[model samples]
Target: MAGGITEMGEPYSPYVGLVYMFNLIVGTGALTMPKAFATAGWAVSLALICILAFMSYMTTTFVIEAMAAANAQLRWKRREQEAVKDSDSSDYSDDEVIVRGRSEPLEARPILSVQRGGSSPDQFDIVERVEMGQMASLFFNKVGVNMFYICLIVYLYGDLAIYAAAVPMSLMEVACGNHSCSAGSVKYNDTDLCWGSVKRKDAYRVFLTIFTLLLGPFTFFNAQKTKYLQILTSVMRWIAFSMMIILALIRIGKGEGQGRPPAASFSGIPNLFGVCVYSFMCQHSLPSLVTPISDKRRVGRLVLADYALILAFYSLLSFTAIFCFAGGDLRDMYTLTFTDSCHALDAAPLRYFLGLFPVFTISTNFPIIAVTLRNNWKSLFHRDGGTYPWVVDRVAFPLITLVPPVVVAFCTHNLESLVGITGAYAGTGIQYIVPASLVLLSRRHLEPALGRGAVNKHRSPFRHTFWVGFVLAWATFCLMFVTANIVLTETKPKN
Candidate 1:
């Protein structure tokens, strides 16, 4: 209300760090991190984390610089204004011309006179403001923004479809266990705790298939209303984090047994890196933090503090997970994996908790993907008159949101595969590539200012180094993961 409503009549509200963090977690981390580590090995995962973090930091700095430049330009122009007094007491005098020329309308006369009077001596202000505004526009408009929107659509729909199918499948597997009609015989490995079903082992495969087919539209619709959806997401994240911690502790205390195989062999270096990346990917929430810290100087400080806290949280969780499941199967790497494998009958509470975590995370994320898609579609077609206005505001939004989940329900009707694919791609783009590119672009454009030491010293070289290195490395990692996923998916035998 304070900021007033826009022409579209929507109220403006500033973003907060918590919201951004929630967005990052639900949109990408919740669904992907577990699977990413599983696929890329810990080392590659860790490399991805470092790269993503660096890129995110860089992007944030650029955003701040861009804002500052624009503001500075405004301030300079405002200061250069020359107050004009009426030379003739009459309102209709030459000095008070209602319209300057035949080509100019009455409304344009004042603005033209102000410029013609040459009231502002500081031309830098105009230049800076123009440049900064253009920069901001570029970030928010342009093909880059469209790319982000498309990426989000792909990620969300893909994930939602997979999860919709995977959840049911995973749940059924856990529920049926030895008594499952599909499972004729159940064999459990000692160290790995891997379970094999002789009959109907492919029961869940149906869900996977359904998930893959419905992924496109489901993700597109889900990405639209990410901003408000984050509130629910935050709660889910904390719950997941808690479940993970408890599961880790339980595994570490009780040795793996009862058909559980040894933890997937950690490629030591790769695993470590993977864990780090998983943790760092959470930092994509940093931008939401920017809006709250109005002062530029304080923004740098806040970012540092935020990163410190993030690192500490990630380190604790990764360490706990690694130590607890030291010799377990990496394929089933989740907070519930330990409980499912070792204490199946006994660890009811942990399993239930873990089960609940995905439900919340997935539900929240589903809406986000839908919202993102709807908004982007509206921006492109509705604004151009290519589509009816009511289509976006009324028909399209609800249809996009509801249709995907329904289709997902018909497909594999599970959440696992949906989460997996969404996590890998959407998570990677939002967390790594977008931020990295923004930083790179900012650095290139603002190089002169940075070189002149015009930026606040405390936020210079160290920050720049982190971002530049981060963008490059993270981009590489994301590309690799995407390629690997495409190759793996394509090469796999079809059911």
Candidate 2:
């Protein structure tokens, strides 16, 4: 019974199961997928689906190996410490005969039984020492710890910025049709309402400000505890998933063509696919998944399950969005698609249900951004404590996470641009580059342990190397695209 309870505490429960599902859907797919599909089109979107799924699986495998290495190192260090302690207390029995007397004869009695008083104390010392040295020289140095930290920072920043924009956008959509706000100016009912009158830009600014100032702090404080943090993260994940689902469905049913601007170039398909890939880019959270599953076999199974679910979700959403909005001027992506179909006066209970997902997504993502900033600040200063107290940390964390996003909201406040920037840079790095690097590095050093036909049974050396190069090249190209797109499409003049 104790063992059963212990197992429950070790991250194998219904809650974790739901949390993983929610994380995959909301963390990557729900938040950024719409934008990817909007830019990349269905074909590229399909390619992204395959790539992201493969990357996710590879990342999971490497993470398991890294965790196993870390655990082994820790065990080795503890054993060494024990050995050193015993060595310090070493003593020898004074009365023990160095050798039996010659008169006793060769086999007559216990000969030369020089008692060390207790055990040799250094019996396992050599084993412990060797293991510790091997761990430090091999595992710790080679793993992409630094790269993960950098990628996490970038990803979280993008997430916070997008959410900061999205929350106000959602609310503005809600407030425009509310009866009390409308007053007696023009008793506009649901049927009579149009998208023109909504103060979308203003609402977006308000949302951005609130997220930066208010939600940022709240999330920061809550994230201190792992349990609550996980729960909050899980809730946000589901919210993001629901948002993507709703947005995709709305785009499908509405059939595009809502008087929004047309695509500036013939790159919508690429952009859309990028967004789809972004939706499944949950590499930052992969470590959390691996930490829970102890058994190597079980880890493989869980990762496979995660990939299957992600593939199914991405495929369905991409297909529906493309078929529904085909040739209908892919301008403003699905934002216009959503706004056109659901008037301010129309009580979209479905949207409200979906709205919960984005709310959690935006809220949680903001703090993660803040935390990343804090971490970077600490690293630069070589500080031992948290970065909460440092002025540079405070300024950088909030400013990077919030200010540009709020300003963007106040200006153009276009969801497509927000999502595009996020996918192009942050998504590319987090989802593609970092994972590929980790896999390659891990395979290089721990080849025998993580190699095919080995104890762990990972991918072949050639296949692993190919993926590493492939993902890095793809990510680099996306980075270039992001730079070009931003240059070409500067925010429209602020009112």
Candidate 3:
């Protein structure tokens, strides 16, 4: 019964867990996807997204299997500690000796057949949130764990940089560009004047500075979003997304659509691959999301349902966008596309709301992400039973987390490139490579204690050893292709 409650202080339901996973997977990446879809072309984009969705679902199951294994391992260790205590006590008797018998090194013990038919409590019920970091420690060597943390940290930095650039870019556009429907046809450059003398780029920096000063300090202290605030943001996200989709459909229906995209574009595949990978990410946070579910028996179905719904939503959004607007007109941030004075939307108030939406939503997330990164930094270097100095603990870790992303944001406001690089490299590790490694290693770690036949009710459908090798192999291919694409793009002669 205690396992029914989540760390968020709410009683768990399968439906609630579904909502959390949905929200986690569909964030900033979804906003950037329409532009990538347009560039990549609609036919290829649809097929590729479906494939990515299935791959992502497979990895999701892998993470859930790893979580159950981690839980079982934790329970096994606690039993061992209790046995040692009982053996050391002077009043230990028959009952205590029976308990001590279970403490024999796992290799010498008989194979404990899987529990079933209501004979005993299952040892693998997920009751505790064993974070990916803790799972890494349990299953990986020192080098592996360090590599995991480094990949995670780099991904977080990319996330922070994208947020930093997006907010200011939105502000600069709203402040400098004409909002009247008459000037919607015009496009402005960074060199254009915001007021009289101030350039658009300069205005962007001013807003970025203000944003950093206002929200950056929260990183030094622990910060988390309250439940109500999360609910409010989720509501805003749905409203904004719905408004864009409806407007695009209305324009297409009116026979005013201007889009004429190609059927396929080979050059666009690498960026689209990164965007899809980023959009489907939830593996790293599955422990926090899945452990609290009251009924995990149907969790595999819940994940399937969520992914189906999300894939449909993405298809609808991207299809409407590419059919409604010309490829060149689509902005990297899809919300900004709605803000333009184009025929799709003309209401000043609604346009402004859509344009500034990222500012409202991403600001709330930046502090939470900053704190997460800071904690990961501390975890990477932490020593058993050793304490950090006050300045090192309170000041230094947060500074390292806060500075790098902000500096990257300051240099370029090109969000597409940022998201692409982040998702392609570090995101690949977190989503594909890390989950595969975790499940593989966790199974080996638990086999001696639980025995090979012990059932993990939450084991992945992709249970074959071949699937694990396949995921790692796919991750390697993606990284190499993306890196080569980047190099080729940079070296190609400019026209």
User: Top model by lDDT, which number?
Assistant: 3
Arranged by TM-score with the best first, the candidates are 3, 2, 1
Candidate 1 or 2, higher lDDT? 2
State the TM-score for model 2: 0.66
- Model 3 C-alpha lDDT per residue in residues 1-495, reported as the tens digit of each score: 101123423448999999999998888779889899988989999999998899899999998898888778777777666655555573544333333344334334333323223222377778888888888888899999999999999999999999999999999988986778876556778999999899999999999999999999999998978989999889999899999999999999999888887889979989999989889988878877887788888999999999999999999999999999999889999887777655667888898989888999999999988889898888889888999999999999989999999999999998888888888999899999999999999989777766666788888999999999999999999999999998999999999
Which candidate, 2 or 3, would have the higher lDDT against the true structure?
Answer: 3
Candidate 1 lDDT over 1-495, as tens digits, reads 001111222222233443344345333233334543444444554455555455555555554544444333334334333322332333554444333343333333432133333322232121221222233334445776567656655654564454565454454445434432243334343222223543333444443344434543454333444545556666666776766766566666687422222234342323333333333444233323343333334446555555555554654555455444433333333544533443332445555656556545555555454555565445434343355656556776657755665575564432334444455556566556654555455545433322433442223334555655756575577567556656776799999
What local distance difference test score does each model get? 0.46, 0.49, 0.85
Say what the RMSD of model 2 is. 10.4
RMSD of every prediction: 8.7, 10.4, 3.7
- lDDT tens digits, residues 125-213, model 2? 11111221122234435344455455555655555556666666555555553333224223333234335653445445555566566
Best by TM-score: 3
TM-score of each prediction? 0.60, 0.66, 0.93
- Native-vs-model 3 lDDT? 0.85
